[model samples]
Target chain A: MTQGRMGASGAPVVSFENVRKVYGHVKAVDGLTMDLRPGETVAFLGPNGAGKSTSLDMLLDLRKPTSGTIRMFGSDPYHAIKAGRVGAMLQSGGLMPEVTVRELVALVTGFHPRPLPVEQTLKRAGIASFAGQRVDKLSGGQTQRVRFALAIVGECDLIVLDEPTAAMDVETRQAFWVNMKAEVAEGRTLLFATHYLEEADQAADRIIVINKGRLLADGTPSQIKARAGAKRISFRLDRIDEPFLLGLPALVNVEIRHDLVQIQSTDSDRTLYALLDAGYRPREIEVSGVGLEQAFIAITAEDDRDGNGTTPGRSDSAGVASYAQH
Target chain B: MNSTLALARAEVRRLGRNKRYSFFSVGLPVVLYLVIAPSARHYHVYGVAYPAYYMIAMASIGAFSGALTGNAQRISQERKDGWIRQLRLTALPANAYVIAKIIASMVITVPSTVLVLLLGRFYGGVHLELWKWFAIGGTIWIGALAFTALAVAIGYRFMPDTVQPIAMFVYFVMSILGGLWFALSGFLAKIGDVLPTYQVTRIGTDLISNQSVPATAYITILAWFAGFVVLAVIAVRATAETV
Candidate 1:
């Protein structure tokens, strides 16, 4: 929220200053303070019901915060929407299922005073050939892409996507990131909500993870993972040696009954060197670094009541409420 | 006015996309006037006015289509699509939306009125009187405004998907069983006298068959339209929910 002049009115592309969205007795988002600059892509990583969409919705002004303030493009998102500056591909996407893709894009663009030409929009959405096809006839992944096209057609400054590629596959998802990188290169800001760690690792300049409705980690993709960092160091011995590795410095506190070692040390480099020096030139060695997915799991799992992905709903409410107190 | 016209054009296009209401807006009144109004003197006690009847029927199509098709459904659709939320945040002002809706109804109503006249001239053996033309056209337009308001007001309460079937049923049931379909007379006839279609229809019959429309009937139809207008204005404000 610390401001400059990206917006027409001198606001950041998006700023959430202690924003809290309360629904009845529950706080969907609590004290979420985030900022996005123009042309930056930030991925919101969280498990289901972790308030990722709720935060996105509030920023999009589809849902209003019960308290605090969110400024998109230096004004309220609702204001930005009217100004035709805030663009979104909501979780619902709001596609008229009966209309052809061309018509859907045309109708949405019609709301803007100076939308991109229909042909260009169709091509950008990657559905130029499917423009005449009915939306109901398209696959879910294809429909998701159409939503993406519509959001960008206004040539808006900020784009908010809530689970944009939820229905996409491995190949399509890879291709989508390529297409998205190209789109982002055109200087549009993106606040993407995604569950895929690899997607975040590949597509995001920065990553923010939310657990129990509060910001658990926020930094560059590599930084956040490094902060919650652990590594899986595995080697295939001639057989299993449990006590031998446990007694060594690199493999200290090793659960080495099997041919596996999980080092919780901050320095994987030092540990791996120790392993090699201890006459442990193994047949095979695998040292996998900490990843965003594991970091999310580790953070949420710390507060988890059960092993399930479900965070005690009340805990998020309490956690978010606690945010306001601070 | 240009803004209103722009919105109106879009609404008209959107309304035409619905098959059920496309018939109500563009097809039903023309088909019925063509097939039925020629021999209205047969069912009625003589001295019937064909053009007045056709005009009332035409005007009511504007009223019906305005309430049931675009205005009513648009309210729900906007709310569901977050269009209302979007507009409220804009400088467009919610009143502009209401004005646009009423104006759009006129866009459809005016054409439907012309089509009805053409159908009456070709198939019903009807002719419009100079004075009767202004009287019936004015009455029909007033009726459309009222119905359009009520339709939008009610339409705002439901989602678009659920609105169509219920609205279509109301229009069809009223048109047929409420005596707009036939000239049934009695207690039901008394109730029909108050219905916009019934009163507008009877007023049109008087204007065409006898070269005179009842002043009382015109006032009653206009009053009903006024009530709808008031409700519509209220509905727009309530749903606007602006601070």
Candidate 2:
């Protein structure tokens, strides 16, 4: 809320302006520029080696950008972190092993000027039962929960989780998100980097896909799906004319095998109507949007094809639509 | 409580929980004293009885070894586990982390120093005045600062697996070279006189014998302490940047 007040003049809660991080010959993060406004639950979706973690490190102030700047709450990342405005759970690694979970959490709580009660933090992180256990003795999932508790104890305005649930079981992951949703309700800006597309599709209001240290796609889930430009309409047709099918409205590509014809269309509704109007009796027709996983692959693959080293996804409508025909 | 003090307290609690630290910081020195002091009790070196001299020697060695290795191992382990990055993400200042380590090392060093002193007084028949006891204990504790810095520098410079062995090797070499094992008399004594470890014991000997400690001893020890501190700062900065 204080961060929101500070952003009254319309500054983003977090911004990266052409930030680049170079490690010798490797450009870990290449000219990354993006912003998260207050209360936006943005997911950083990328494959491994996609610069997601590198970008997160710069945002967390653990690593400095080689060029440009990263601002959190209108100040540098370190200052924001120092002011207790940001909290993070990194992908791997852990707390001090010798101390009990509660003590480690309490120690982190002391680092902040205003922190949530340790009990409440432990409860929210779902580690209250094991709070007395030494950190080194915890299972991988339990250690992650302890780290999550440490992150929330500060009650920071911006919570950055790099694969927060990477080690959790199915049930634990579900419960973690349930608690995460409650935290999000507090209107804090949340940014999480994860390889799990389902997590991004379900948890993020806006998803930014990065690949090879470049932004591949940035939009809402539906927008990204639409940008991917392919919807599937499958049906069993006794007889089909391939040319006629390809000629149908909004049809991009058509595939036929045995009695099954799979239509890849930019607008499945229009394609379906065209199929019906053309007197083709297609039985058991099913329509579905291109899933996030497919979209993610397609987007990154597009970047791979362009290979011209030019920034491709900067323009949302034209850039994505241009690739629709291909 | 301040963040630094809170972190330091946690470090102390960690040291308390660590069985290996307890063994090294308290048990090993006392064991070594018990094993070696009796046979050397009657042998005199440099106008002091060997038991009394060896008592201070074992105390210094144990305290220094514990402080250096303990701090370095903990820091290297933290770095390996990404705890240092976690700390960097918090509001805790970088220097506070270093300072907390120094404090924790000192806290852990105390038990060994005291235990060895008491062992000297009772079993080794070390009959120093009260002021001399205080002075010896105080000198050993202060001398640990150099090792603390050395350990911190090593922690930042090396990986976790190598940190301990490197610290132990440094400690062993310094202890031998500085005459903590036995009193050196010629060129070896000259080399020992220049090292901080030798100066630490020399100052303790001066306290017990009621002799004024030469200014060179203070200068050498302080110089090593300063050099270690600078190395620690540079090493920490280098690791932070590369990380």
Candidate 3:
């Protein structure tokens, strides 16, 4: 299964150079630029309508970019895909119906220049038990697994998936990542687009965040968290000095409702100390670390505010909550 | 090319499993021929024996129904289900899906055409030279191929729900007016003169009667085929981004 999985050069496995896809008046992907290295598990993080699907579509050569270019394996995406170097399972990707799972696997596997044994792929996708079942008759999760099986049916060096676990339950989602990890361990580069923040945080070595059809942030989990603000501090003060509180050290954002002030800071201890050193006693002080979910919210919400100038400070939580639903 | 052929092979196998396809393309025709051809022995159509003419009619009915309905509905449903998109992700070439579908349609037309002619031979007692049989079958087979192109156009250009009625409408109009169900005369004959289905039957009956087929018959079939191919190309290209 991992025959050609060795000793790739330093060249990036995939790269998008200012790629854009315009649909009439809407810019689906606007000047998006990024690159993926070999053996890297990168998460494409975005909200609904954040151009994640469009970008992945362009990368897979399913949809052409209106401007600029995308390259895979240092070649055009279409040629690289035709060479059977990249395997993909998109949310829109569907199975051939009216056939047994095993037959569908075998048929697709035969399309590859270097194909794997069909039984091994069926087993790896955890679909061996239902291999005899018709594809259209399976449950949603089983159908998803079959789609995943098709992606790994060949000796691919890169795998791209869009919301692969969207239909899976928690237990199935965990099992899926375990199976996915085994595939990536063969030194294959994996790029998956997902809105599930924890999945992105847990599975990806690097996370590339996009918002409104552009790159918002690209870094490791910790760096993204830090860049958004590592700590959140909320306190109540008897004498509310909003301006003075906003001026606190290491403050990233400040939200005030009467005497209750919520603060997001890079260093919570420093901000709190500065508040006390300013001769103000704040009551009910609470300081906590920010999870990747909150950090993602902060990053995207900030972008939304900057981009549209309509969703104000309160949108940080509201916008993210709505985005998480999709 | 190999991948496309593999896809076409799988398509053929799936079509074999479909009871609806089998009934429309072979079973229905064989049953219809058994029931209708015996009683029509005294009648004649377009200078050919009634049994032989009905053979062409039944064969044309089966081939047209199978080629148009089975393929159009499947293509539209597959597009809606994202099967076409999934195939696009494979290492197969871009046009492989459409080509494979056309190939499968052509392959499937064979059994139906041959079955109807065989019924005409042993059961209907319509005798003809072996080459005439081949010519008739081959002509009907090519007509089915032409309809397959129109099916592709309909499938690519519309969703499954819309394709259902459109394919049915086309099937009824072509089969009835083109004299697949009955021989045309007077005004209906004038109207049926231009249809590819009527022309296909004309070609078959002309071959059976040992008459020179009209140039207009060939021109009508070719024009429809060329027009349908262009329509299929345009539909496929229009949906390129979405597919």
Candidate 4:
């Protein structure tokens, strides 16, 4: 998921080496290893039970991983944070109802050696207008933005976020990404976990997928998609026999209902041409690259796939080795 | 601005602005002290001055009020919301957070103690000299730090919803047994002496009565303050580590 520090080569700013965290008997994070580099923005993606939040907690050192090491700026994340190196925003927005945004930022900056100008930090967070508004009066998205502002309100080097935009509308989410891109452009590092595949695709140079407490995939967005393989191909044909289409090479699985035709194919192009050969004039043709959503579903939907769908290699040490060997 | 003073200013603003926090910290203490002081005027346990008795009880009420409210719930909410973690992102040090909490505790405690004393003096038949004010203020300041440590320990160790009940219980028990009249029973004095409230009361009443404080109570109060400071130091470390 994350890379180790690259040394004079510019090592990662955040690294998780075979980290494990358990709540009761439930393994919230299992053998998860990941890295994030300075000026690099990485997206962590997974299903409902995929341990994204737990991994964040471990990375932030709010909850120590039951096993393994997590480092930020090449030190224990919590220790580094105490040393004024890391900033974070959890899923639930953090703002004291009693304090205004300016007050909050001012209060938190008190925890640092060289805090940013309060007004500037508020402007960066887009809550400058609400600087005097108590937190309880702010809307959810505003509160989230305020929380985001507070995180970077410190001049900390690393930013860790869990579901940074879950409450925002599409417009605000985009605005947030644009702001994040600007921050990353400033040579800061970011690690955020989210369920929105589009978010990962847009915000992260690298995407990591976790399923059932373990890492299922980690790479550049295309790399993860490449590993997930070409999973979906949909089209509208003049007319194509379902059985005939299913019989085509790499089209062994096909579903046709009404005017919509869907197929899971290893070689989508091969299947597309065959439909053309069969005198099929389509009203619409669509082919999806193994995007993060496809990658996420493919990586997590294996249990019900029988023997048909692709599954990443199950490596107990596979995830661990990724970090150890690095 | 000085960090502690800034923290205290913000804390006072919080208590004033939020009607709920204000009511709990400001209004409740005044109302309760008013009601409590008037009711206690007629009662005395073992010849204790009812006025001084009420003052001591009300002071602990102030202590619990100040200690329990923002110190824990606010911190917990901030912790839960990722605010503290966000603070870590800033150049802010962890000590500021502890300082802020202590300031908030004092801000809450000061007004609460003042109002309770006013109620005791005006209506509760309590006569207090300037020195008595100084002694009470000094002891209460020490008690504020002690209570803050307890509040933080609870806040860090328990969920917000869960912590309120425990704090309320401590407030109730400390006010009742450790005090004389608002106390559930005067008979509980033997058991009350072990509580910080009782030691604090012993210290306060001694000062108010213009008599020498028992060396034991001063030692106990000092021990109480030291115990809390030690615990708060540990809790602040945990907050930095865990939050």
lDDT of 3: 0.89
> For every candidate structure, what is the RMSD over all alpha carbons to the true structure, in angstroms?
5.7, 3.4, 4.6, 5.2
CAPRI-style grade of the A/B interface in model 2: medium
Query: DockQ ranking from best to worst?
Result: 3, 2, 4, 1
Which residue pairs show collisions in model 1?
A: B48-B209, B49-B208, B49-B209, B52-B204, B53-B204, B53-B205
lDDT of 3 at A164: 95
Model 4 DockQ (Cα-based): 0.44
* DockQ for each model: 0.24, 0.73, 0.83, 0.44
The second chain of candidate 3 has a TM-score of 0.98
Cα lDDT tens digits for candidate 4, B1-243: 365566567766776676766676567666766666666667764345676677666666666666765576766666666555554444444466567677767766777778777777777777778877878767866766777877777776666787778777866676677673354344577787777777777777778766787788777767877886777667667655466
On lDDT, the stronger of 1 and 2 is 2
Q: What is the lDDT of residue A322 in candidate 2?
A: 35
Q: Which one is best on TM-score?
A: 3
lDDT of each candidate versus the true structure: 0.66, 0.83, 0.89, 0.70
Residue A169 lDDT, candidate 2, scale 0-100: 91
What is candidate 4's CA lDDT for residue A257? 87
Question: Largest DockQ belongs to which candidate?
Answer: 3
Write one digit per residue (lDDT tens) for candidate 4, span A47-138.
Answer: 78778877877776667777898877777776787777777787744556667677777776765655788888888877788789877789
Q: How well is candidate 1 docked (DockQ)?
A: 0.24
Cα displacement (Å) at residue B36, model 3: 1.2
Candidate 4 TM-score, C-alpha based: 0.80
User: Which digits, one per residue and each the tens of the lDDT, describe model 2 over residues A1-326?
Assistant: 12332233456999888889999999888777777888888889888898988898888877889999998998999888888998888975458888889899989999987788989999999999999998899999999999888888877888999999999998999999999989988988899988788888898888888777766777777777766556989999987788888789887567899889987677988889988898888999898877888878867776776755565444542354333323
lDDT of 1 by residue, B109-209 (tens): 77777667666666665677677766666666776666777777677666788888767776776575444555556777777776766766666667676
Candidate scoring better on DockQ of 1 and 3: 3
